[model samples]
Target: MTQPILVIKDMSIVFSSPDEADIEAVRQVDLTLTPGKTLALVGESGCGKSVTARAVLRLLDRNANIPRGSILFQPEGEAATDIARLKQDSLPLRAIRGNQISMIFQEPMSSLSPVHTIGDQIDEMMILHEGLRPKQARERTVALLDQVGIPGARQRADAYPFELSGGLRQRAMIAMALACTPQLLIADEPTTALDVTTQAQILDLLRQLQSDFGMAMLFITHDLGVVAEIADEVAVMYLGDVVEQGSVYDVFARPSHPYTQALMSSIPKMARKAERVRLSPIKGTVPAPKDRPVGCAFTSRCPYAFEPCATIRPERTEVGGGHHARCHLLTRQPVEAVA
Candidate 1:
């Protein structure tokens, strides 16, 4: 098999409060993104999906620190380099951020500068990462907007982000992320706030762009429907850890972890004609970072929890080829009820 474009081995991120207590926001998570594939990090809000993505780009604030593990990146034909250990000032990872790896955030209004015109915003990265001259960068920027399906690209380039509609702003953000033609794109719920039709367009645009670029994608979303549309693989997260991970087909069809099953069951389905569809919500709220559970962070809400599950954390065990789940029930029964 070809080497992966990015490899995250046992990556952990912790936040230290003024009282000196450490809160693990991400715990020993491992993931890989190969060329021409998409990995969806799915979970409820505050489950550390976004934290994990930000850690890969070293975009975490000073309050957060990487406690363990490494994030390795291998450019198409280059030697593997450890991005986690690189100095902030001398980060060679910059070469990957916009040139080889890029990110499209949830809110375009907040992510794109209000002061900068759409064209200037996209051109800035090209200038910095690709070293393109001003005029050349502008030309590419216009093409990028058009490529993302934004009509009247040349005229819109001169407009400010606030002046554009939600969908247009998002398309502009996608254009900016693709300006450097990155090999890996991290999208953090890029369609969270858009209308349904706009969301569909954005997702289709992303899919089309992924095919055209053949870039690996780490797409973070809470919507299972969106995952079904674009993900080749799925990693279900809870609290600070991945509870289940496998091919999109297997994980969605036969979810092993209680959390994974609950999340899938919660999605509103269309085929069923029952008076009311059953919604299995994982009980209880996500525990505060400062007060995480001792064993499985999801133990409080898991229906299959036993004494061992509450006291001893389960390591990720292979359930099948490329399918793994962190749960004690897998040890007891081949299949068990999640709710």
Candidate 2:
């Protein structure tokens, strides 16, 4: 069996507050990513998907702390390093980030510098990580821009981020993320801001790049359509917990958790007029971290929630080949009996 490149076990993220109680944004979440495979982390907004991804890079805010968990990353022919324990500005971490692992932010405009040319920005990464001279780095930057389908890459590289359109800006961000040819890439809603055509193109570009580089990916998004297209494995999160997880084919084929089922039902299905049905919008909003339920975080919103769901926490139950769900309904007595 192939070994996993990254493993996150029982990770919980908490944010400190002065007057109020500390907020636990993520709770005991586990994820595994293998080399050259894509694992999609799907959930609604404020569901801790982004926070969990950021933890792998040790990029959380100062107020945020990992009270528990281990983020173990194994580089090729190297010993496993626990990223969770590394200091934010440690030399070892600085060497690993942007070299072995890179991240693409949700917004290109905000992530890219307005003062620097796109070429300079991308070149800096190569200079820092690969120790390449300015002249050589510029050559590689232009090639990277072109590789990401940017038109007039040589000239465009000299232009500031504001000079490019949304699609071009996003492409530049991708180029920068790929400059060092990282072993793993964390993409946090990389295509969320683009138009439909641009979104598809970006997705295709990411897939092509992943194939070319043979790198693992942690794809974070709320869109099921995008997940279906780019993901090999899928983990469905709700509130601060991973409710269901399995292969893309398995989870999409047979979603075991109620939250997962609700999310699937909310998708816009393309079918004949006779077969069409109204979209089922999931009721209730996600509770704040401080307001998280004692048992299942999604108990307030879960339609199939039972008596045990409100007070007694449920453990993960196997749902066949490598598939699992954290739900009381999976292991408890019949739903009708509980109801």
- Which residue pairs of candidate 1 clash? none
**lDDT for position 45 in model 2:** 95
Model 2 Cα RMSD, 1 decimal: 2.2
> CA lDDT, every prediction?
0.88, 0.92
Error of 1 at 275 (Å): 3.0
Query: Which stretches of candidate 1 lie above 4 Å from their native place?
Result: 75-78, 333-339
Q: Which candidate achieves the best lDDT against the true structure? A: 2
Reference-based lDDT, residue 302, model 2: 85
Error of 1 at 252 (Å): 0.9
lDDT of 2 by residue, 1-339 (tens): 778899999999999988889999999999999988999999999999999999999989999999899988983447789999998899879987888889997799766999999999999999988999999999999999999999999999999999999999999999999999998999999999889999999999999999999999999999999999999999999888999999999999999999999999898777734785788899989988888889988889887887889888789889998999999988876447554
- The alpha-carbon lDDT assigned to residue 135 of candidate 2 equals 99
- Residue 334's lDDT within candidate 1 is 50
> TM per model?
0.94, 0.96
